[model samples]
Target: MDFSEKPVLTGDRTVLRPFTAEDADTMWEIVNDPEVVRFTFEPSTELTLDGLRSWYGVRTADPDRLDLAVTDRATGELVGEVVLYEWDPAARGCTFRTLVGPRGRGRGLGSEATRLIVGHAFERVGLHRVQLEVYADNARARRVYEKAGFMVEGVRREAALRGGAWVDGVLMAVLDHEWEARARTDATQVTGEPRLYTP
Candidate 1:
């Protein structure tokens, strides 16, 4: 895992790149969105603008994590972030998390960002697995995770509370072998070649 050299990962619709303090403006929107706040964090949690600025500023210094801003490829506007953190070196894996602001939602940017970052993890970092947890009620995010090759392991029932209601968190993960197969499938769509038998 080479954290020293962060790379800009591009996809059809979105680009994932290292963070800049200027992107803090978008964080304001993301942290305040009802859906982002309810699903990603405790409903009562508050994010001060100054706090977010400091948080995003030091992302590059962390040697064990990767925090990249997700931006629209065409507009170059910051949408959200795709992060690989909480690293377990012995396991050769890390926790994956992402979110898209209102401006970037409902357009497949989230899914594409998932694929771009996950691809970098498995292919470049040699991680054995990448895992994430989505609230059971957040079906949209679960679907996106599923589409990106993450399979549900189990439910952490009543693991979180939102609006005074307990919500289950669905644990999902993608393994190295699974990523390899997914990569082949993605390539097949482009070249129409059955590369499954190559390895």
Candidate 2:
């Protein structure tokens, strides 16, 4: 998980690349969306361009985190960002996070982008597993993770407090083997291709 090396991943509708200080304004706009930040622990606030730029500088310098900017290929519009955090070489695993703007929601961009990231992690980075914790209330996000082949491994009752009430947090994970099997199944459905990777 070398953060210094940026990987360019192109999906059907979007492209993911390393985030730069120049992208601060775009990132600010996306993260400031109340709906986008509702389920996450981070606070949503309006950031001055300078403040965002400074933050990006520090984040991009981190050596163990992979933070990518999601962009629409056709329009070259900055839509959102996805992050893989807590890279551990010994464990060969990481945690995932994502945020997509209002205009980018419901188009399946999040799911597609997630699939691409997971593929890159297991195939390119040689990670054994990728995991995420999402609020049980975020059904849409949970569905996206499930579609991408993550299984719910555990649940923490009343783990998050949102909207003045306790909410459950679901822990999900997909191993390298599980992802390979899923890719094989998808390839078979799309082109009658034989399985290439097995769990």
User: Which candidate ranks first by lDDT, i.e. highest?
Assistant: 1
Question: Which tens-of-lDDT digit does each residue in 15-123 have in candidate 1?
Answer: 8999977778789888788888878986567788988889888888888899999999999999999999888988898999998899999999999999989988888
Off by over 4 Å in 1: 195-199
Ten residues in sequence with the least summed lDDT for candidate 2: 39-48
Whole-model Cα lDDT of every candidate shown, in order: 0.88, 0.83
Candidate 2 wrong stretches, greater than 4 Å: 43-49, 195-199
TM-score of 1: 0.94
lDDT for each residue of candidate 2 in 127-153, tens digit (9 for 90 to 100): 998999999999989998999999999
Question: What TM-score fits each model?
Answer: 0.94, 0.91
| Per-candidate alpha-carbon RMSD to the true structure | 2.4, 2.5
